[model samples]
Target: MPAVTVSDITTLARIPEPAPSAAERGVRSVTEAPTGFEGEGFPVRRAFAGVSHTDLDPFIHLDQMGEVEYAPGEPKGTAWHPHRGFETVTYIIDGTFEHADSHGGGGTITDGDTQWMTAGGGILHIERPPEALVASGGLFHGLQLWVNLPRALKLAPPRYQDLRAAESALLSTPDGGVLLRVIAGEVAGHAGPGATHTPMAMVHATISPGAQLRLPWRRDFNALVYVLSGAGSVGAERRPVRTGQLAVFGPGDVVTVAGAEHQDARHPALDVVVLGGAPIREPIAWGGPFVMNTRAEVLAAFEDFQAGRFGQIPAERVPHGDLGELPTQPA
Candidate 1:
C-alpha cells in the first residue's frame, strides 16, 4: 500500500470522471440527518441507526449535538445512565464536558478531546456540560457515536480512552489550506491513540478556501461522511452537500472532498467528519441504552443494573464542579 499524504489526496482535484479502476468513486446518495432530543432533552441530529439506515454495520448510531448557542445556565446534558454491549465515542469540538462513570472513571474533556467509553457488560455514566460553562453561556457542539461490539466482545470489561486534541494526528495540505484531525485509525502513516475491539476510523476535517483532500480508506469497510458546517463537494463527481446532510459512499477505498467558496464570509470553511468500519454482520438487539445479540441479554443487562451489579456513584462524587445554575436531571 502506498503512503497517504497531502499530495496523494489531490489526485482528482478539478477532475470530472474518475479514471478507470480509480480507487475513488462518486456519491451514491445524499440524505438529511434526522433531528431529535436525547440525554435529558439534549438536542441532536441522528446520522444513522439500526432502526433506520441499517446498512452501517458495526456503527449502530451517530448523533450530532448542539452547535446551537444557549443563554446563561440553559445547557442540558444526561445524568447517570446504564449501558451495555457496546461503546460510545464522544468528540468535543467547541466546549467543555465532564464525565463520570460507575467504573471509577472521571474526567474533564474540553475542546478537541475524544472520550471513548465501552459499556461492555454494563456501566452507569453521566455526561454533561461543566457548571461553569453553563453560567457563562456559549456554544456547545460535538458528536457522540455508538459503535457496536461484536458478539464475542459484547460482555467484555468496560473501559475508557481519553484522546486529547493535541495528541491527534493532524493532516494538512502542502500550502496549509486544508486540515484533517484524525482521532482514530490512520492516514498518511499517522495513527490515533484510540484502541478498538472493532477496527474503525474517525476524522474531523476543516477545509479552507479552495482546499481539497483525497482520503484512502479500507476497501472492506463501509463509509460515510457528515457535513458539520458550511457547504462542500464530496466524492469524485463533486456532489454538493450542505450542513446537516450525510453523504453515503459506494464500493471504493477512497473518497474526495473539496471546500467550496461561500457567499457568507462568517462561515467560509467546511467542517466534516469521516467515519468507517467493517460490518459486524451479527444479530443486534437494541433497547433504550443497551445493545446485545439477543433480547435475553438485553433483559439481563437491565436486571444487572437494577441489582446494583454495575456499581454506583456517590452523590458527593458527582460532578458539580462547573454545573452552574442549570437544573440537573437524573437518568
Candidate 2:
C-alpha cells in the first residue's frame, strides 16, 4: 500500500499535539465493509456500507477498490456512465487507472495520484484500466469517494482537478510514528491540494507498529476512520478495529488512532484513511448515478440523461482490453 512515503519521516513537518483542553472523540461505531464487485466486475469493498446517512452527510459513498493482484487480461473497470449533483474523488494507492469524461476531464493516475471530478449539473464519464495494464496485469488498489454538493451548487459547472502525489501535503506525527498524506482539506496549518465543494478533510496515514497518531480535528466537521489494512484502535476509547472496518467518532476536537504491536507479514503497518466533512443536512434523493435534493429532481436528472442532455461520449476512448499484443509485464 505505497501511496506516498519518505526515507526519513522525522524530516517532515510534524502535526502538533492537541491542546490540553481539546476533547478526544469517542468511538461511536465500528462496522466492517462488505466485499462486492463494481465497474466491470473488479472487486471492491463498500467502505461506507451500513453507515447512517445522517452521520455521512456531505459525503455520499465510498469504495475501497481492489488491493488485488490481477493476471493478464484480468484488469477491469467501469463502463461509460453518467453522474450528477456531486463530485467523485479517486485516489490511486498502488496502481494505475485511466479516466475519461464527456466534459473533457480525463487523465491517467497512478501511485498516490488523484483525480477529482465535479459532476455537477450532469456529465458522462468512464473509468477503466489502460490497455497495457490489462495486457500485463499487476496490483491495483485505490479508493473512490462520492462527495455530495449542497443544494445551491447542484447545478454548478463541471470541473476537474488532477492532483499529483507530489502536491500532497505530507506530515508526520509529533513523535514521527506515523506518516500522513493530506489529499484534501487542511490539517493543523498544512493544507492538501484538492479543492472541494464541501468542507472536508481526507488523510491517508500509515502507522508503524505500536505507534499512535493524534490529530487536532475541526469541531464543526464530523470524523470517520476506515482501516485499509492491518490492525488498529480508534478514538480515545481505543476501540479495536481491523482491515475493512470503519470507525466513526463522536463529537470532539481531537481524533486518535494507534497501531497494534503485531501485524501480519503481508501488511507490516496499519493503514487508514481518515475523513471528515461539515454536515450538509439537506434532504438527499439519490438514484443510480445521480444525487439530488429531491425525488422529483432526481427523476428529472434521469430524463435529461435519457434525452442526451448530459453530453455524448468522446470519439476516442481508453481501450479496456483490445490491445493487439499482450505485454509480459506491466509497463
Candidate 3:
C-alpha cells in the first residue's frame, strides 16, 4: 500500500478553532479547562482531559486520559482508528498498555515508560486493554499529548522514542515533591532532553499534601496544570482542581501553587501534571486522528497511509523487538 492522503479520510477534519490574540498568550492567572467540549465524536465523558491549543500554541490537545476502573474482564481499550500528519505520545505512570499499529510497530508500555509515535503522512491504529494491566488490577492512569510537527517534518518520517524510568531524570524538591521531567526545551537551568523531536513541557509532579511550589515558565510559552491525585489550588487567583481536572493559566512567566487544607500532610500524595509549550504559530488543519497544515497536505497524508506509505516497519536494530503483526484495530 502507498499511503492514505487527506482525501481518503474526507474533509471531516480541519474544523475551526478559537484564535485568541497574541496579548492573550502567556497565562498568569489560572482557570479550569472546562467541562463540555462540543466537538469530537467520542463520548464527552470527562475522560478526555486535555489542553486544547486554544490560544498561545498549536500543540493541539493534551489529554490526561486516565482510564476508568473496570472489573477483571471488562473491555479496556480504544477501537482501531486512523491518524495522519501529527503524532501521539503515550506516557504511563501506572499499569501496562499493549499497542500495535499499521506500521507493524507494537509493544507493551510499562509504568514510568513512554512511547512517542509520529503518525506522519498517514497511519491507522488503536489503543486498549493490555493483558498485563488487565491482570494487575488497578486504575489506569496516563497522558496522551498531540504535538503538531512543523510542515517540513510532517511527512519526513515516522519515528519512535521509547524511554524507560531510569533513562530519564526525576527531580525532587526539598519538601518531598517529585517531578518526572520528560521533554521539551529544558528545566531548572538544565538543557533540553534531546529526547523529543519538538520543544515541549511534559512533567509529572507529585507533592506531599500541604506542600507549596513555585515553578518558572518562559514568557513566550503556553502553560497549564492537570490535577491527578489530591485536590488543591493554584496561582494568586486560587483556582481549585480535583482529580481528573485541568487548570489553564493566562499570561504569566511563572506559576505559583499553594497546598490547601484538604491537601494536608495526612493525605500525603497529591498528584499533578505540570505541562506547557511554546506555541507553534503556524497554520493548522486537523480532523479525526491526524493533524497537518494545509488541506492539500492533509489529503496527501491520508493517501499515503491508505497506500501503505506510512506503515513501514521499523528496522530490526531499532530496539522495539518483534512487534508481531499489523493491527487494523486496537487490541
Candidate 4:
C-alpha cells in the first residue's frame, strides 16, 4: 500500500464514495452481540461471540471498549500482554490510547486514530491511557477488533501501522447529512489508508435524521454492522438496530443504511462501523490470547510466551510516551 502524505489527503478524502447499487436486497439476520468486561476493569461489548461465527469468518472478535467517563484521577487501562497468530486493530473515538510493544514499536492514538498491529510469530505489548489523562479525568471510548490471519501467514513477522483521522478517505451525502469514512479497503474507488493481509473493509459512518446511504459491497465478503450510538435501520428488510447492537448481513453486493426519520436530538445521528472480510474457512483453535489452526500451534504459542520469546516491557514503565498529551483530535 502507498504511504499517505499530507499533499494527497485532501484530494483522496474528497473523492466520492460508491453509491449503493439497485439490486435484489435481503435482510440476512439481525442479532445483538453480548456485552461484558475484559482486560483489567474496562467494559467491552463483544460484537462476535464464541470461538467463531461462520457468518463472520476471518474476523474473529470485535470489542467495543468503554465509552465510560472516568472520575478525576481514577482512570484505568490494560496491562502488558502477549498475542500471536493474528492482528489487533484499535480505533479510538473519544480518548487517548498509548501503546508499546516488544519490537520497540510504540505510539499514541487518540480520537479518530487507528492502530493496526499484526501479532504474527509473537509479541508482547501494552495499551493504556496516558498518565496525563488519568491525572485529569476525561471520556474514554474505542473499539478493538481481532482479525484472524490465514494459516500460511500466522507465523509471519510482526508489524504495526498507525493511521490518524486525517489520513482516512472521507465522503458525505450531497447535503452533508451523512458521512462515510473509509479506513481500510476502497469505497467508490477511493482507497483507504490502512493495508490488510486479509481482504476487508472498515468504514465508520454517521447519518443524521431522515438521511439514507447505500454503499456497494463485495459479494464474497461476510458483512456486518455495529451501531456505535443512536438508532438506525438497514438492508431491504429495513432491520432496526440501536446503540450496542450488531447486525450481521446476508450475502449481498450492496448495503443500505438509513437513519431514523425522527431521530433523537441528543443522539441525532446514527453512528456505526461497517466491517466485512473474505472468510478463512480453515479450522481454528482459539485459546485465549492466541488463535491458531491446530491445538499444537496453540500450545507452542503459550510455550513461546512462557520462554520469554515474545519480549516484555517493565511493569513500572507505564504509558511509554507522552503521545496522549498531544491533541486528541487530528487537525
TM-score top scorer = 2
The residue-level lDDT of candidate 3 at 325 comes to 36
For candidate 4, the per-residue lDDT at 103 reads: 80
In candidate 3, position 273 carries an lDDT of 69
What tens digits encode model 4's per-residue C-alpha lDDT throughout 178-265? 6778899987677789999999989888877788777778888877888888887988778888888887777767777889887676
**Candidate 2 lDDT over residue span 107-224, tens digit each:** 9999999999999999888888899999999999999999999999999999989999999999999889999999999999999999999999999999999999999999999999
| Tens digits of lDDT, candidate 3, 1-331 | 0011123222222211122322223334333444432111211224223434565364666655444454576435564556766778777766667667767666777666677788775665556656655665555656677777777777756666666654544454444433334344565554323355556677666654566656666666667777756777776666666666666777765665555556544345567767767677788876455577877666665565556665543454234333333333212
Worst 10 residues of 1 by lDDT: 322-331
TM per prediction: 0.87, 0.95, 0.73, 0.88
Error of 1 at 122 (Å): 0.5
Candidate ordering by TM-score (highest first)? 2, 4, 1, 3
lDDT of each: 0.78, 0.91, 0.57, 0.79
**Clashing pairs for predicted structure model 1, backbone only:** 130-322, 131-322, 131-323, 131-324, 132-322
Query: Where in model 1 is the C-alpha error above 4 Å?
Result: 1-21, 49-54, 318-331
Question: Which candidate has the top score in lDDT?
Answer: 2
Model 2 lowest lDDT segment of ten? 322-331
The list of candidate 3 runs beyond 4 A from truth reads 1-56, 135-137, 177-185, 191-194, 264-268, 312-331
Between 1 and 3, whose TM-score is larger?
1
